[model samples]
Target: MTPQDSAGRGLFITFEGIDGSGKSTQARLLAEALRGLGRDVVLTREPGGSPGAEEIRALVLEGDPDRWSAETEILLFTAARRDHLERTIAPALDRGQVVICDRFADSTRMYQGLSRGDLRGLVDQLHDLMIARDPDLTVLIDMDPDTGLGRALSRNGHEERFEEFGPDLQRKMRAGFLALAREFPARFRVVDGNRAIELVAAEVREIVLDALT
Candidate 1:
């Protein structure tokens, strides 16, 4: 469905950054902050937000790095996103709740476009064809690749397929995300994520609150 087709009364916010940039944490914190203000908040993530999407998440994140080709991976991610939008995000937005997603199409665009190949046009086309609505605001947690990769590696999980691509790719992804922020300035809020968690969260909270106001 297109953006105009899925019009809702709620706010949609998404966090975008390379892995270990603390986007997930920040997303959570922002949700908590909003909820504290008595707003209905739906905290979610991509690759898996709805039940079907979660299952697809495992298929994409658990397999070997080369298990799926770039094109195939994009398809899987898009499918998961479609399910997420249908079963989870759309309903929450229709309820007028604030929906904060950890990662969204931007991740797909950067990961598939940079790490895999120059398939950015394909990503855009697929997104426009399948899922076209962007978040009302996208918080981009910007940080150095080395620090982000180190933090990502420190975490324990089977969802390491993307992380296995290593630091060089992370650097490229970082650059890609920043470029996207510039490309869509009205919807992008670039936050410095290299500071302590409290500092980053405070800045992110302020930005989001301002948007709501």
Candidate 2:
């Protein structure tokens, strides 16, 4: 659905891409720009937006790469998303505030569906059964997997479960995200993310402004 078709309530915007695609940075930039324009904006991220969800995020992102089986990982992600929607997202939307999220259900679809296993059906089914709301506008920061992987690996963090999947998986994820954008053209905007941060953020700002209008 279009941003204007959100039942006249708040706008829900999400940034999506393979790991290290700079989606998180762009999400923050968009939130800052909208707030600068005097709009109420809530910045959040998936798998860890709320208290309970943050706990879930630790479980999903920590430990060995095979800490959880593919099916179990999907279930944990769904649980975290349910808590995020109930505790954080729903309240912000109710207050007519724009919500900028770093990642959302789409990440689960691509990471679990493509990276872990061929569980796209399971991802869709779980999302439909639990969290069915889609972002009004999803900005997909598209980039080459090799570059993205390099950027992601250069960072230091204990939450490297997904990043540990390496380059081949990252390539598959990039393709999956692009395919998802194609599946939801009206709600998805593909932004070239290989440019400088300022340039990419500028393009993102323009896309968000257009959606808000």
lDDT of 2: 0.90
- For model 2, which pairs clash? none
Candidate 2 deviates by what RMSD? Answer: 2.8
> 1-213, model 1: which lDDT tens digit per residue?
322223335889999998999999999998888777777889999899999999999999997899999999999999999999999998999887889999999999999866799889999899999998789999999999999999998898889998999888999999999999999999999999989999999999888777776
TM-score of 2: 0.95
lDDT, each prediction: 0.90, 0.90
Count of backbone collisions in candidate 1: 0
Q: Name the runs in model 2 displaced over 4 angstroms.
A: 1-8
lDDT of 2 by residue, 1-213 (tens): 444343346889999998899999999888888777777889999889999999999999989999899999999999999999999999999988899999999999998877888999999999999998999999999999999988898898888888898998999999999999999999999999999999999999888878777
- The 10-residue segment of model 1 with minimum total lDDT is 1-10
Error of 2 at 131 (Å): 0.9
